[model samples]
Target: MTSRRPLSFWIKWLLLIALVLGIALGVTRALGKRKATSEAARATAESLQKTPTYTLSSTDVVTVQSIELTQTVALSGSVDALQTAAIKARTAGEIQGLSKREGDPVKAGEVVARIDSTEAQARVRQTARQAESAQAQVAIAKRTFDNNQALVRQGFISSTALDTATANLSSAEATHQAALAALDIARKSLADTTLRSPLTGQISARLVQNGERVAIDTRVFDVVDLTGFELEAAIAPADAVAVKVGQTARLTVEGLSEPVQATVARINPSVQAASRSVLVYLRVPALPGMRQGLFAQGHIVIGGVTALAVPVSAVRNDKPQPYVQVVREGAVVHVPLQPGATGLKGTEPMRAVEGLPAGTQLLRAQAGLIREGTAVRLSAPATVSN
Candidate 1:
């Protein structure tokens, strides 16, 4: 400090000091700006994370309720007529007069078709002629026997001759009886050539056409009574035990818009050997447009119980334990469920569950999956006008 220095040197030193201070100030301001930016980014990230991710509608959630749950067993099968008959050819002959086709109405004992009766008629005529000839021979033999008896009484003929005449008369009578029986059989064959409907119903099929030769017991047509119908459904042996006659069912029949009502009419006493299933017959009322062979599927209500339940779809199995997503305190909460008996509430399937109180609102199947601790906002339910 005592040494004399040039003014330029001092100016240079002062300028260097000023440059270092400027750099320090610039660095401090840059660090403060970077810290403020980082804090703002963190705040934005937290806000986004805390915000509600899903806004659910009223229909998206289902409320747990104490309901009378109807336990049911699923079934599917074909619809069959309660009364059906296969019209078969009773005699072997050429088919004729078969005017009835499928869907044609037929009454009881109505002649639906006929076979050619030429051979049958000829047989009948031949047997009848034989019977007449035998009858004539019987008359002649009887007259001879009477004459022989008189001659024996007068001592003109031996008793052996009278016995011979009596034997001849008996033989003639037996021949006549045999001829009569043959004639009756031929007549019956002729009658059988005409096919008759066994029941009052509509024709379901025409297996033969006119002029087609058919053998005895050949299926010619199928007749079905459409006044009522039944469904033959095979059920599991475990479920079949609870099934009983007179239980109600609702069936969705193929090609029919409205659900058909059915009743459990009969259950098979024995299990099917091949499938190890039990056959259950459900009686369905005949309605407009009902037809045989229609596919049907439904459930048989076996029993009912009053319990806390939720929709069957509400139960989720994504985790190791079965659980249902519940809404509580405006957040998604997963409640572990001990699923009990499954049943139906009206037409919707509901499942009985424990570990949840009645009136707990739950996320439906349509709500998809929401993360745990995620916020949710449910729309207000619609108000009904009085």
Candidate 2:
């Protein structure tokens, strides 16, 4: 520092110091930028790690339980009267004094219609007069026969004459017997003009009108007993075996607001050839507004038993075999089930399932988004109401 240097030497020394300082400053700035970039990258990575993953919520979960399940078989049919009778004209004549029409209520032995009885009554009277004349002749014949017997014994007349008188008396008695029989026939024919109902029911149809000529065996009316109603349903052979006499049924008619109760009365012994189904007859009580020919559907209770049951909606059949979605350890598990007897769950339908422990949670409805091993959040467990 004390020695004086040349001007060029001094300049060169100052330039070298400037270059060294510039390099040091540039290196410091670069290091600072690198440190900031690394810190920002670390912060972003930590934020991503702290965030939670998305999951699905399961709402239709049902807990499997041991309950009393009533098995049922579904059936359909038309409502029909237990008794239907067709009224026919018994005698051939013009319809007269017609008293009943369609929808008219009738009682047993009530006169429904009357035919013209002018000819019938005249025939009866004529036959009766003839019978009276024949009876007088028979009385005269008896007296003549008695007198002839006394004459033959007293020899007042020849035996041959007595025999001729006996023959005449016999002939007169035969004529009298024939006239009486003819009178009886005419009286019965006259009474046949009046048509009476054999049963107490309502007239369903009136085939003949007043003053219309009809022949014997003509269908004059159709009567149906509405007090006792029955449903005749056809059941498939597979289900027919389960149905039995005395089983209760619930019927739903198109016009009725509530289901009608009925009991299984009988079953046809032979299967129908065309439908390959068995016919089941069910007895129904007379309701306020039930009529004939109303279509109805029903279910017969086959039996009642305790079983591990689930709602029919809960069971799925997407796979080759039927399966159910179960929630286990907060994950969806697909369980294959061996389904058993199908039944009702208090008006709702249910099916019996095996190979699952009681109290296992199952899905009430199928979820398209849920699959095996998928994590789920469970809501409240479903409970069946009585």
Residue 224 CA displacement from its true place in model 1, Å: 1.5
| Clashing residue pair totals per candidate (backbone < 3 A) | 0, 0
Give the poorly placed runs of model 2, Cα more than 4 Å off: 1-59, 158-167, 236-244, 267-278, 317-320, 329-334, 366-375, 384-386
TM-score of 2: 0.74
- Per residue, candidate 1 scores C-alpha lDDT tens digits across 58-144 of 788877778898899999999999999999998999999999998899999999999999999999999999999999999999999
Query: How many angstroms is residue 1 displaced in model 2 relative to the true structure, after the best TM-score fit?
Result: 49
Per-residue lDDT of candidate 2, residues 79-180 (tens digit): 999889887888899997777888999998998989899999999999999999999998998898889899999989988987888898999999999999
- Residue 6 accuracy (lDDT) in model 2: 88
Task: Compute the lDDT of residue 36 as modeled in candidate 2.
Answer: 96
Best by lDDT: 1
State every prediction's TM-score relative to the real structure. 0.83, 0.74
